[model samples]
Target: MRLPDKTTKMEQAVAAIPDGAAVMLGGFGVPGTPFLLIQELVRQGKRDLTVIKNDANETGMGVDHLLVAGCVSRLITTHLGLNANAIKQMNDATIAVEFCAQGILAERIRAGGAGLRGILTDIGMDTELGAGKPRVTLDGQAWMVETALRADVALLHAAAADTFGNLRYAATARNFNPLMAMAADTVIVEAEQIVAPGALAPDDIHTPGPFVDHVVHIPELTQEYAVVRR
Candidate 1:
């Protein structure tokens, strides 16, 4: 189906997501996240979601919205220092947290996109992370093998997207969006601007349309945060 336009609401954009699905979220430090759509998901009371992200919610904002709504069941992230609510929930045994190194997290998603079984890295070796997971030897050396990470759905943010779904991000705002797009079964993008097809220059396209399944414009939500300038 063709992607939705800017006039479409967040509920409409996220309607295809079923309850209890795994979702990979794009953004880091509240910069490029699709907050409006995520808020809508919480409002809809979708439950038991497994989320993969760079970090837990920021201290005062971001993914904590989901945590507060009790929509998330599990989180796989690099750090959890920011969102106090999430920490409290975890400590209370209300949420399950799985920690991974930042680089390893990115590589796992990349491996998912490339159809590889997993990625081998030393970042988690000789620690609690390496003890339980399977290890494999490559070139006579042991590596902490992380499985490829594919989510049932992926939530992404972009600076601009064409009607056909070619996407572009502004500067550092790119973050984990593009990689998550490729690694998910259903890739939904929230954009600040949605133009007619071909409006984005070929050189500026960070993600091609085939990887995107849905697109919706939600510019108002991003105005509160710093966006990458064109």
Candidate 2:
């Protein structure tokens, strides 16, 4: 069957994401996230969601809405420095947080998509990150073993996407979206522009059609102050 288009709306794209489902959100900070779709989920009161992303939304954008709405139960991310509300929630034990280095997190998702069981990395050793996590010995060297991460659904943002689901992202905005697309059972992409098939050069496609299940078009809405330039 063909995939849905960006104009299909967030509700239609996310209808299958249950209350307690696990989700992976695409973005490094706020610039690359599907903010409209996240807002819609908040409006729908979808709670107990386990979200995996790079960081919480900045002060006024991205996943911050979900955090404020209490829609998220757990968060696995590289940083939460920009989100004071999320930090407070984590401190208060309102939400469970799993910290991982950015590179490792992306690799985990890629590994998951590739059907790998887990990965051995020394990035977390001798630190809080490796405290209680599983470890494995590879060639007589102990490495922190992180399991592959997959999600029931993945929410991604793209600069452009075709009706056939091929996606293209702007420079730095290509953060975790591509990996999330591969790791999730259902991939929903929010794009600013929707083009016809083959409009994007094959070499430029960040995420291919087979990995995308749905597309939601959100032409720049109100400008929010949540994103900060690096």
TM-score of 1: 0.91
lDDT of 2 by residue, 31-102 (tens): 678777788888888999999999997766878989988899999999999889999999999999999988
lDDT of 2 at 156: 89
How does model 1 fare in lDDT?
0.83
Clashes of 2: 1
Model 1, 1-230: lDDT tens digits are 54444334567768778989999988887677777778778888889999899988665456888898889999999988977898998899899999888988999998998889898788768988787888778899988778999999999889899977799987777889999989999888888888987688888899998888888887576443654343
Cα lDDT, model 2, residue 141: 87
